[model samples]
Target chain A: MLEKKTHLNLLYDFYHSLLTDKQRQYMELYYYDDLSLGEIAEEFQVSRQAVYEHLKRAEELLHKYESQLQLVAKYEQRQQLLKRMGAILEESSPDLEELKRLVSALKNVD
Target chain B: MLEKKTHLNLLYDFYHSLLTDKQRQYMELYYYDDLSLGEIAEEFQVSRQAVYEHLKRAEELLHKYESQLQLVAKYEQRQQLLKRMGAILEESSPDLEELKRLVSALKNVD
Candidate 1:
């Protein structure tokens, strides 16, 4: 079971890395643009099943990448750090020096 | 310039994929957990420079992945899709049938 999970993760990562422009566009339209599958299918002049397949593949790719590299996990961590830094900055605490030091450390991250 | 950018991208991706547990931990503590470099250095019983170097390497890794595979970009796209789907669901539009189809499509992604 662990091995299967690991395999799925690797596959997700590779698929995520390999998405083409069209796949990305379709994803944006269907998910973000709030288009229905039928709407998307009509826009692309493809069958609903074809649109479904593309989305499924894209999701799989994202999962694969997450399992293998944990990119999303890391990104979320960074975002949390940014939020903490923002809070610290707002508080005007005596620990401002420490915050600055923390900021400098983060500067080295990206 | 493009070549340089591409090189950076590749390096970032490779580094991101290769982060060790120690490196990831350091990243989480310093960036997400809001630890100061001095604090992190003390915790790890290492020099500040060593900590900085680890962070620098990790940031390089993330940027490398962004450049090569655009994982972050894709994740953002997915998040947007989810949000849109949520919005559509909230509206209870006549397109709900399409929304159902879209949901089915997204299910295929994972």
Candidate 2:
């Protein structure tokens, strides 16, 4: 459950702007704001089923965007690149070949 | 006109997979394949107006994606980082402060 929440939270970070207002609202409340479905439904003066459906649809859209864009995946790659560079810098003499390789690979990242 | 085309073409590269088959078709034919609207319309057995609408909607979505996600903007920044790193590598001894600053900034890129 925690893993799923973490993944969804990351996806939300990358693709929330693509969502509609209600979709965005539900996600924020359920995930970030830590509100339960019942609480959200009561606040919005809607049925629990309606809130669930909204959250479900919003979750599905977040997954869809992540699958298509892979922004999160690319983001991880970028982070890995930075960490690798930091490791290289730690060496007595920076690894010239490795840094060159990283630089070349970095060029194609975008 | 050429600048718009160039910008759209780059946008298309990053977001093409998000487009529908018809939108992808229209964009490729009109941009990369360099087909006129009339030519694409004739080939697809659709009206020029239909083709134009598809291209316009696709282009709008591309712009929307860019504005929200900024993948293209991020991609350009990544490229710039590589160029800057390349310049550093060309030096007899890379400026350590500059390289460290780059590594730190790169962590926030995604």
Candidate 3:
């Protein structure tokens, strides 16, 4: 199983824009900002269960979008390829700092 | 104003997965498959106006998603950078076919 934080982070990266303002806010608080459900509920003046349910629905929507699009998967593959290419470049010229910088630029592209 | 075909193509690329089956079908037929609205309406047993409305809504949703995310913008930027890098690589070593291939691979990502 994917780690919860890792999965939520990738999903938020890919589909946060598609989510409603409330969903995005909750996700940002719960996942990226590291707030607990009770804390989020108190912040929003909602029940803890309501906050949990909202997060669950947001996750399901993100999963549905990802299943259809595979953008996150493609991003991960590109990142892996860039890392491998960086390794090759390092082997060819350990002192080529410019090449390393270029590789880093390409890898961080998203 | 952006050309209608070009705008639709980028919108489709970025948000097609978020559309309904009917909306996706209408868009694919009109933008990608080059079918006229009337022809698409006939194929789907809907009126031309209905088909046009569906395509319009799909375009609007795509634009909304894009406005929030800017995925298409980022993709175009990456392509431009890749082309620039390719030019530099070509100037450095015109006979480096492997490097050219790698540049092509990076450019066609997505």
iRMS for model 1? 13.4
User: In candidate 3, residue B44 scores what lDDT?
Assistant: 82
Residue ranges of candidate 3 with Cα displaced over 4 Å: A92-110, B92-110
Model 1 bad stretches (over 4 Å) = A1-18, A100-110, B1-66, B69-110
Q: iRMSD per model?
A: 13.4, 1.2, 7.3
DockQ of each: 0.05, 0.77, 0.23
The residue pairs found clashing in candidate 3 are none
lDDT of 3 by residue, A3-93 (tens): 9779768878877878889998998898778899999999999999999999999999989888977778867776665555545544644
Q: Per-residue error at B104 for model 3, in Å?
A: 17
lDDT of 2 by residue, B46-92 (tens): 99999999988999999998998888888888778778988898788
Q: Model 2: per-residue lDDT, tens digit, A44-93?
A: 99999999999999989988888888888888887888899888987888
TM-scores across all candidates? 0.43, 0.95, 0.75
* Interface root-mean-square deviation, candidate 2: 1.2
The TM-score obtained by model 3 is: 0.75
Best by TM-score: 2
